[model samples]
Target: MDIAARSPIGTRLNGLAAALGDGLRTHGHWVRAAQWVVVLVYSVLIVVPAVLPLPDETAHVFTHLTVFSQFVFWGIWWPFVLLSMVLVGRVWCGVLCPEGALSEWVSGKGRNHAIPRWVRWGGWPFVAFVGTTVYGQMVSVYQYPKAVLLVLGGSTVAAMAIGYWYGREKRVWCKYLCPVNGVFNLMSKLAPLHYKVDADAWRASYGPQSALQNTPPCPANGAPNTARTVRIQPVNCAPLVAMRKMEGASDCHMCGRCSGHRDAIALTVRSPNTEVVALGGHLATGWQTLLILVGLLGIAIGAFQWTVNPHFGEAKQWLAEWLIDREVMWPFAENAPWWLLTNYPAQRDVFSWLDGGLLVTYILGMGLVMGVGLALPLAGATRLLGPWHTQRFYHLSQALIPLAGCGIFLGLSALTVNLLKHEGVPVYWVGDMRLLLLVGANLWTLALAQGVCQRYATSRSRRWLAQAALLPALALVNYQWALMFWIW
Candidate 1:
């Protein structure tokens, strides 16, 4: 039992957790109903805005559905959804995601085929995330309604199609293919709430049961006995997690379908560092590290910073000047379709081929540089810990989740700030808030690094040396953020 489970305050907390878990179990139908409601709203937001004309300079979020959808989708919905993953695991994926719900609903009545081995490939999350991030930048997914429909709506369609082809009643798309699945999985390791499974109870309940009924000879003992069947209803986990083996919140969607099964699983509280510091050495993988170091910290930062960075402007100008002097005119043409590149004429927001090419280059360049910069120190720390241990290297990478998650949140919330600023809202506190979050995230990550070091280091000196090796990576991350928030 957990030490906290013995105290009065802990007892109350446990009771609250149990009640919450039981409520979900009992009111699952209500959750389904709520999911449908969200689906309706999501559909309207995605579809209705695409058909409407683009909002003009005089148009406000309140006055125009297109602008309102932009604010809702980018400014509020996505940023808060990212925040929710760290707070409560993937409840959004389980209960409120229109795509997940729609995909599963379609899958229930569709062909229930065996999942192909290629479909089960583990690297899809990282590949899909990078693909979508780069493509979204190329098309300006955050700015235009058409781009939102293309990127987000297109993802929904693919989800349903994959569901139609894959395992019955399972979130195969989410488990393997969703663009944000890797991000959510990385951030969810820090969630305070998760479905806690009691392994001992699971073993006891699933063990062989002996019963006597009529007259059957027992083997070897020569006793008369009969076998009686005992049945327990199986849990239908849509994400297809093994309830008995689940140790972290990364894969479980928190749907509560298996809660209280055989008096074992329950929603419970835990330290946010528990998974990263303890289980990460065993569970961490190279792909997850790539998603953190490259995808989130590298690609995401570049995507958010390019528009605001003066270097992008200078580079584009230099390229344009060279192109003009060389008499190359095609790159200057804004003839690309809105579906391919951001070409919206009336709003005067169109990306020429030069713009699109440079955007991709800039984002990828940032990703490579930042990814290499961050990886070096982690690699150093890993080497300092001992001779090449791949698991320990990946485990140390887990310590950066707090900073990576915070950086992404801050980037998304920057859109929120820009949208509100356009609405004439005062946001004087945003700067201070950003600083506080950055400091807090850095401190949290440092503490997690220390805890992880404690697990691997054989001596006190070795531990301090390993931690010292990590300081450069922390400094690099802080410098990147400082450039965006302070220097820029």
Candidate 2:
């Protein structure tokens, strides 16, 4: 009574913290019910319409967007989801992904074995991402429901199967092999808030078995029953992320399973660049750098850009002329089938062998061009910054996330802009919009690069020199983007 009376404010603060932590972790039946409702709605809206035939022109409210499914999936859903990852750190993955939920539900019914060794490889995420990306493009997954079923639906089935076989009541499929897993991991590092633990307090409250009753079970899924000398790992971490060593948001699914374990952890706010500027050196890899700089920035640019790119047209025309002189028919033959290209004859459109070849050339050429453009400068930065190594280079290269992310966003947004324009909505300011986005991305990248040099370089001169080395590559990326968005 004496202690309580003496420190009423402190006691109230402790009580408040406990309530906040509990609230953060709680996922009531209504929440689960809402998620199930979303899952059902997604299945109807996304998968069902993909199987239904493409709608007539009058059915299309937003011009050539053509179908409600396509419009909602691409026009509204994907663009905003990507933006949400930057702003909210994968709340979509943690809370609403139908595939993720299905996989977990199935795993609850299956063998519940430990994840295998091969599944734990770091490279699988990137490989899965590239495969998904390439396959989506090959099948024109966005425009066709059958393709969507084959691509997105098929992946969902695979995820459930993986969950059933590989882990106990967990999301092994997502943590290990989901195609967008790596992209999400990289993007999540830019999130503005995350649950952070105070290890000391956690250890104190749960240091022994006798303390168990005093420390309530987390009450979340797989919540700890009674605190004891805490194990080396968190018991309920579904994504299998090690809690103690979690300094960044990259591996966190933010499931809140660990919340209020010892009254030690809480949601905290920080800058989006917190991880990129601090722990990136250790987390970055050459593959990720290449994926961002070339795969996303280059090949993807061409994938999105080719339709509007006159250079692609000239190249295709030149090839057509050459083939005509020789009288070749293979280019005109739709021999490869619909799965390999856009071959919807009912729509009065199909991609011939020539179109497919040209697309491959465009994507590869852009990758080569933009990759070399960025790589040579990074090589130069490595030489100037010293202690040259691929890992070091890769780590330093991550400073481009801001620029790369912006490029990807703008590319996706072009689909939105195109649809709106076709619907007869005025979009005269799109060029200016692209310009603003590009400029913002460039500045953000430059600022991050300067931060990288400051944190990693040995001296002030080296920092400036490293930044100097980065400018040429950044300038080239911006120049090319300008060419795509404005000059061309």
What is the TM-score of each predicted model, taking all chains together?
Answer: 0.94, 0.87
Number of backbone clashes in candidate 2: 1
Q: What lDDT tens digits, residue by residue, belong to model 2 across residues 1-488? A: 11223476645644564454456468535445766987897788766676566877566554332366676777778778777777767667767778888888888899988788898887777667656666677667777777877777788889999989977778898898888777777777777756666778766765574366465678786576765544443456667777766777778876666766555666555567777877787888776887777777787677777777788889888889999999997887876777778788898768888988787777778888998988999888877777777776887788888787788788788778866775678999988888887788788787778877776678889988988998988888887677778777
| Number of clashing pairs per prediction, in order | 0, 1
CA lDDT scores, all candidates in order: 0.89, 0.75
Clashing pairs in 2: 50-145
Runs of candidate 2 with Cα error greater than 4 angstroms are 1-24, 62-66, 208-235, 324-328
lDDT of 1 by residue, 1-488 (tens): 34246688766776788778888888999999999999999999999988988888888889999889999999999999999999999999998999999999998977988989988898998899999999998888998888999999999999999899888888889999999999999999999888998888776665544223223577789976545544676888998898889999999998888888877788888788988998998999999999889988899999988888988899999999999999999999999998899998877889999999999998898889989999999999888878879899899999999999999999999999989999999999999999999999999999999999998888889889989999899888888888888888
Minimal lDDT window, size 10, model 2: 1-10
**Given candidate 1, what's the lDDT at residue 97?**
94
Q: What is the lDDT of residue 133 in candidate 2?
A: 66
